[model samples]
Target: MYLLGLGLVLLLMKYLEVDPVATWSWWVVLAPFAAAAAWWAWADATGYTKRRAMEKMELKKKQRIDKQRESLGLKPGKRR
Candidate 1:
């Protein structure tokens, strides 16, 4: 995400002819986007993406359960 943001900023700077960035090659300005793509590919291949998504779902589920329990005057379950 940081790489993507950097790539966009560099692109804008280059487009606006902002000093050193304007003098840099398009490849240099665009490298962060390529890096971001590589990072995403690597994350997907390593199951990191899936694990994060599953964790998010689990958190949401636990929160929903806790909210229900609270509404019924019950205590929230202990965290693992």
Candidate 2:
């Protein structure tokens, strides 16, 4: 995320012909995008994305079930 934002800033700086970025090669302006691609590829290969999604889904489901239990005047219990 930081890389992408930095890349956008660099792109804007280069486009507006700012001093340091203006002299930088296209590769410099584009490196963040490449890094992001590589990062995403690595995440997919390691199942990081799916694991995060599943964890989020589990959290949401737990919250929902807890709410239901609360509405029924029951206490939520811890689950391992």
Candidate 3:
């Protein structure tokens, strides 16, 4: 998506016969930093990374429970 935006920007500059280096100096300087910050903000806001971490933790917990049940010679879904 960012690449698409950059391609469009370049195409527009070409079509307009503008010196992109001059016209887009600020963008060149700022776009990458802005993109990185936006990505970080979105990740933080959506808690996607946090959710993944939680999922891993849950899986580990389930594995440990299964191991304990096996050690007890008990089958899952059976009340003892």
Candidate 4:
């Protein structure tokens, strides 16, 4: 995401002919986008993306359960 943002910024700078960026090669301006793609591919291949999604789901589930328990006058469950 950071890389993508950087790519976007560089692209904009290049397009607007911002001083230093305007002087840079197109390949240099586009490098961050390529890097972002590579990072995404690596993360997916390593299950990093799926693991993060599962962890997020588990956290939301726990929060939901805790909210319900609180509404029912039960204490929040202990954390793992």
Candidate 5:
């Protein structure tokens, strides 16, 4: 994510003709994009992406359930 943001910022700076970035070679300025791509590829291959998505979904489900229980005046259950 950081690499992706950096890549985008560098791209914008170059396009805007900002000094330092504008003077940098295209390869240097765009390296972060390649890095970001490689990092994402590695995360996907290792199931890190799936794990994170599942965790997020689980959290959302828990939140929804809690809201329902609260509306129904039910006691809280065990925390994970």
Candidate 6:
């Protein structure tokens, strides 16, 4: 995946006739790296393991709904 991205970037630079390293104005080259870093940081901070975050979120949502149902005096097992 890393090699693919690097190859695509190099292809794009070559096709665009842009000197990625020489052109100081090439902030585009940094965009993908910056985005990946930010995404990783956010996932790390949120305790979001890729395999478990979705399941955890779903569990929290169900618990919230159950709490709300109890507050409304609805039977817990009664599915709407």
Q: Tell me each candidate's RMSD, in Å, in order.
A: 2.1, 2.0, 7.5, 2.1, 2.4, 8.2
Candidate 5 on 1-80: residue-level lDDT in tens? 99999999999999999998999999999999999999999999999999999999999999899888888898656455
lDDT of every predicted structure (CA atoms): 0.97, 0.91, 0.71, 0.97, 0.94, 0.69
**lDDT (C-alpha) at residue 25 in model 3:** 56
Best prediction by TM-score = 4
Off by over 4 Å in 3: 1-36, 77-80
Per-residue lDDT of model 1, residues 20-76, tens digit only? 999999999999999999999999999999999999999999999999989988889
In model 5, the number of clashes is 0
Please provide, for model 2 over 1-80, each residue's C-alpha lDDT reduced to its tens digit, 9 standing for 90 to 100.
78788889999999999999999999989999889888889999999999999999999999999999889888886556
Task: Choose 2 or 5, whichever is better by TM-score.
Answer: 2
Per-model TM values vs. the true structure: 0.89, 0.86, 0.48, 0.91, 0.83, 0.38
- The segments of candidate 6 whose C-alpha lies over 4 angstroms from its true place after superposition are 1-24, 50-80
Decide which is better by lDDT, 1 or 5: 1
lDDT of 1: 0.97
lDDT of 6 at 54: 80
- Model 4 ranges off by over 4 Å: 78-80
Task: Write the residue-wise lDDT of candidate 4 on 1-80 in tens digits.
Answer: 99999999999999999999999999999999999999999999999999999999999999999999899898899655
- After superposing candidate 2, which stretches have Cα over 4 Å from the reference? 78-80
Query: TM-score of the candidate numbered 3?
Result: 0.48
Residue 44 alpha-carbon offset, candidate 6, angstroms: 0.5
Evaluate residue 6 in candidate 1 and report its C-alpha lDDT on the 0 to 100 scale: 99
Could you tell me which 10 consecutive residues in candidate 5 have the lowest summed lDDT? 71-80
- Across residues 1-80, which tens digit of lDDT does each residue of candidate 6 receive? 36447646855775687765436344555566666677778878877766587898888998998899899999765865
